[model samples]
Target chain A: MEKKIAHFTIDNKECTATTGVSIINAARENGIFIPTLCHYEGVKPAGSCRVCTVKVNKRHLTACTTPVAEGMEIEVDTAELNDLRSSVIELLFTEGNHYCPACEKSGNCELQALAYRFGIMAPRFPYQFNERDVDASHPKIYHDHNRCILCKRCIRIIKDEKDLPAGSQGRSIFAFNQRAKKVKIKLDDRLGKELSDELAQKAMDICPVGSILVKETGFKTPIGQRKFDKEAISLDNSINLKAMKEAHHE
Target chain B: MSKPVIATTSLAGCFGCHMSFLDIDERILDLIELVEFNKSPIDDIKSFTKDCDIGLIEGGCCNTENIHILKEFRKKCKILVSFGECAIMGGLPAMRNDIPVKECLAEAYLSGPSTVNEEGILPNDEELPIILDKVYPCHEIVKMDYHLPGCPPRADLIWEVLHALILDVDIDLPYELIKYD
Candidate 1:
């Protein structure tokens, strides 16, 4: 079946994408950048982080979840939107015990990158410093709850593909445990046993924060050379994995 | 016109930020030429001799003494800059913020593996500063004019801010210089 095309304007720039494509994808197709924290490729958009929020017809909408409509007028990169994004980043920083200095994911973490991009000298909100648990049960990785932003990318991404998967979806390796305020990502006790080194790296890579970390890989890259350390996270290209690998190898 | 006077103090910090400040290298000569040091650890001044044009505060408030000195700096300095991650958001010391202060004191003095308190005393003395319930960033205790965020706030960034503030110019921080780690 032929797919319909949707044309839209993002920040007054003409953008076109296939129908059902999210605003973020359409913007990306047009080389227009919409910053996101929780949004990841090949996974369903959760729209939990709210970092990708954009003004769609003067109303706030998550760019990753909202499909681009014909003649849709979307506002991105305005002062209001930038301020809103900055506030979200700040809120995350304050809400979590993100000790960037000691964190293994310091230079590579997307949350820290966003904070840097926004020029967040200090968070306006008071630090919560809530007590969080760390899960070292997994052999390949450890989960530091203090640094988590509750993005749920891991919960949505990591799956038991080792089994004969019926379709695109597989048994979830990570899931949300507990309820509001106490909500956190939990690694599947049984399925997590099959977690390969490659999957472990992927989990750490996709986390956007230092919450999920591969064992024995702490501080692999030195300061001033890690991902997002030399280059600011631009709108078009975010979290360059190849460049990060090159840095790690070097 | 008289040179702007500067005062600096470390509250709950590791003095790493101050070390980074000195990491300005030969710029120390330039900094001295640009400003005068007043009540600062570098000068060994115990009390403020006069009102300071700028005050650099390192670390957060973890004790009663930190609060007292921070308030004193707020009173004495015209423009106060919270220096480094500790002063900005409690940093590593804040890792214990979730645990009870009693637990912390116990671990430090009474119950920890390395601790050797013969009498099992918690060091409750009037001479010792009273510990607060939790670590607090400098801004929470007092108004701050600016904040430099980093483990040690990259010496170049500190230099830039100093230059801008001293010269009364806007800070044009390069993308690379503004890092949180």
Candidate 2:
């Protein structure tokens, strides 16, 4: 069956997308970047972080969860939207104990990259400095609640291996849950110990912030060579090209 | 008119930001020509002698002395800039924000690994500035006109901001100059 194509206008630009594709992915395909923290590719959009909020038919909605419809009018980039996004970033900064200088994921952190792109010298909100715990009980993975933005990326990507048969390949070793305004990610101790180095690194990479880190392997890369140090996080190839131009100019 | 007067201080900082300021290399000549230093560590001036056009503050408020000096700067300077991560967000000193003051004092003076005090006594001299309950960023205590964030803010960032402020021109912060760490 042929997929139905939907045409829409985003930020005064006409774009075409498939009928059921999310506005974020559709925007990406058309070279319009929609900044997001929680919506990872291939994972179902949780819409927990409202950074990707855009106006849809005069109503504000999360672009990651909202499906594109025929003749939909979307406003993705505006001064108001940018202000809202910056505020969200500031709230995330003040709501947690994000001491970037000491974080293992300092140079490569997505949250830090967003702040850099937005030129956030400091958060406007009052710092909460809430006390949080760091769980290093697992052999490989370390969870620092201080840097978590509650994006739930790890919860969606890492599955629980408890129910799987013994020695089953591709079993998940991480578990996470939210309760009473508190959210936590836990490692299945038994399975976590058996996790391969590659999988452990993948878990560390999956985390947008420095909340989850692999033990014994931090600051391996020098300051100038880290991921986001040379280039900004790009949602699409066009954005990457733009960043490349700026980097070249610099 | 006379050169724009600039004052600077390090409250609860490591002086790393001031070191980065010097990292502007030979441009120090240009800075010296552009502005006159008033109450700065570099000039060895202990107190503000006159009202200044700009004040560059390093580190956050961790003690009574920090708050007092910061208030004085706010009153004496027309524009106050938080010069580094410590001044903007308490930086490394903020690590103790989670621990109680009593625990911190005990660890530092009495029960710490390197403590040599046999009397188990805490320092309570009138000369010593009393420690606050927690380290606080500069803006929380007094209005901060600007903030430059870095472990020590990048030399280029400091240079650009200072240059712009002196010239009364709008600052265009390049992407490479901005960093949190």
lDDT tens per residue, model 1, A108-227: 889988888888889889888888989898889999999888888888877887657466578789898998999998888888887888889989988999999999989988888898
Give the alpha-carbon lDDT of every model: 0.89, 0.87
Model 1: per-residue Cα lDDT at residue B88: 93
Q: A120-151, model 2: which lDDT tens digit per residue?
A: 99899999988888988877778898998888
Chain A TM-scores, candidates in order: 0.92, 0.87
Clashes of 2: 0
Q: Using TM-score, give the best candidate's number.
A: 1
User: What's candidate 2's DockQ score?
Assistant: 0.76
Enumerate residue pairs that collide in model 2. Answer: none
Candidate 1: tens digits of C-alpha lDDT, residues B1-181 = 9999999999999999999999999999999999999999999999999999999999999999999999999999999999999999988888889999999999999989988889999888889999999999999999999999988988999999998999999867988887776
Q: What TM-score, computed on C-alpha atoms, does each candidate reach?
A: 0.96, 0.93
Query: Alpha carbon lDDT of residue A228, candidate 1?
Result: 89
